[model samples]
Target: MEGPIEIRGLTKVYGGGFKAVDDLNFVVPKNAFMGFLGPNGAGKTTSIKIITNMLSATSGEAIINGINVMSDPKMALADVGAVVETPEFYPYLTPMETLLYLGSLRGMTNTEITNRGRDLLDMVKLTEWKDQRVGKFSKGMKQRLAIAQALLPQPSVIILDEPTSGLDPRGMVEVRDILKELRKIDVSVLMSSHLLNEVQEVCTDVTLINRGKMLRSGSVASLLNEVKAHKIEVRVLSPPALEVTNQLRSFPGVKEINYMSDVVFNVDFEGAEAEQAGLLLQLQGMGLKVVSFKESGLALESLYMSLIMESR
Candidate 1:
């Protein structure tokens, strides 16, 4: 019943009065896929370093599940798996051997290591390459292996920093697919990323930060729904005529319309729920077969850009 992560005034400062993280506070609930969002130099990496004990906080406390990381790091991190950045592997070692070594370091017995390692390799879709040298694997493959290693202990909370930072389109897709699977297993995850689309696709909740400060935090759906005005994409069954396009503009509550194609258009509208419903009905009454209507704006991107500008 406990939340997986909590922070109170987590501040980090360097020698010359550079505050990397400033009075940050947030809590990630149990099994929450929380996206820690920010631009470069926004203290995301610095905060993660403090949580994993890579660096000491200038002030404040970070608690993981019920253990205070600052006071009892060993116990606090016992059930936590973190990948702060790109993890390197012994190129000569195979996936099986690599995991065996890592497991031995964690005091896992031979039987436990073998069994768990096998399962982890399978989970990361590397079962076929278990005996293959890691040196032959691509960057995406290595990243997957890193993730499997992070889950070796079956940790309750997983912390990832820029998990898909640099990779080909295919690699990025593969990693994101794996991240989506984590939610099905009920693992709490905190992934940091500056990419809005990536976070929007993979995270259910988000905490946006800028210049080492918290800007907003909430559920993705709720945040998107909170926007007062929206750019809506509408697709009709047939090519819309000039008169039909003109009719779209004259619709109540529609501020403007941009023609995207014969059958598609984007409408900027400011309206309440009831008004929107009425507008849709009016469009249908105009003899246009509506195929789809949905918000076209990327709400997270909009929010992130606005907050960053305000912080400046």
Candidate 2:
């Protein structure tokens, strides 16, 4: 059950000499749920395609466990399961039938398929729908089935691209719950998504990419800590006037303010530790009843924007 996915100096050049992935280098640790993060067209998908052997890299290497994908894709990817995008199942096939067909293609015996299929269906909470036609399933149900399909081969590492993309709120939650379950099973998952919150919630580590270049790679906590910024949530006894709100925004160290409710709001403050401490005092001095004040972790959205802007 080896799970490390290593990429060294990987590069992908298109016909017009545009490089989609430029000498990217990183490693998804064994049994780590790592997020492959980037803006659209930032080579996230291209790098993943190279790893899955769907697209050939112009140069460099992708090694899964100890085997090189470029040298021998079959052996390297034999234990890898990937859901690059939403896959369409046959309209008439039941979940059980679809899995059995897929399992047979993978050279599993009928007994193996039946036993493993049942386990996977249960894992995905699809036991009740196992015999139901896929045509009647919702987008979320289809996604759950897709995950079951990926697990049928007992892969140690699962690669998913935007697994929650295009789903409704409930569907997103369903998919996210499944990802959380994978973490409990010691299955390394490399999931690519633009949703920063999703990565923050589901991934232990992350590799950030922009314009075919690696921006940062580290544990989520470490990355957030590295951001030399502060977001503070403040609660007041009552909402302030327009002028008072404007005054806070125009403060020397305050970068932005977002109203959460009548008496609560969050502010992005860029200042030293001393300045942050003085902010609450300053608000109180302005005749506002500052009920509570605390520094919040840098939001993934803010961190991402900061990095993206800095990269640009």
Candidate 1 local lDDT, 1-312, one digit each (tens): 247899789999999999999999888888889999999999999999999999999999899988889999989988888888887899999998988898777777888978988988887889999999999898888998998888887889999989898878988888898889888876889999998999999998898888788888778888767655667899999987888788778877788998798889888887766777887888899998999988776767766776787799
TM-score of 1: 0.81
Q: Write the per-residue lDDT of candidate 2 for residues 1-312, one digit (tens) a residue.
A: 233798889999999999899999988988889999999999998999999999999999999878999999988988888888787889899999998898887788889988999998997889999999999898888988999998888888889988998899988998898899888986788999999889999999999999999989878888876665678999999998989999999888898999999999998887767888788888998999988998775366667778899999
| Candidate 1: segments with Cα more than 4 A from true spot | 233-294
How does candidate 1 score on lDDT? 0.86
Residue 259, model 1: lDDT of 77
Per-model TM-score on C-alpha atoms:
0.81, 0.86
Q: What 10-residue stretch in candidate 1 is worst by lDDT?
A: 222-231
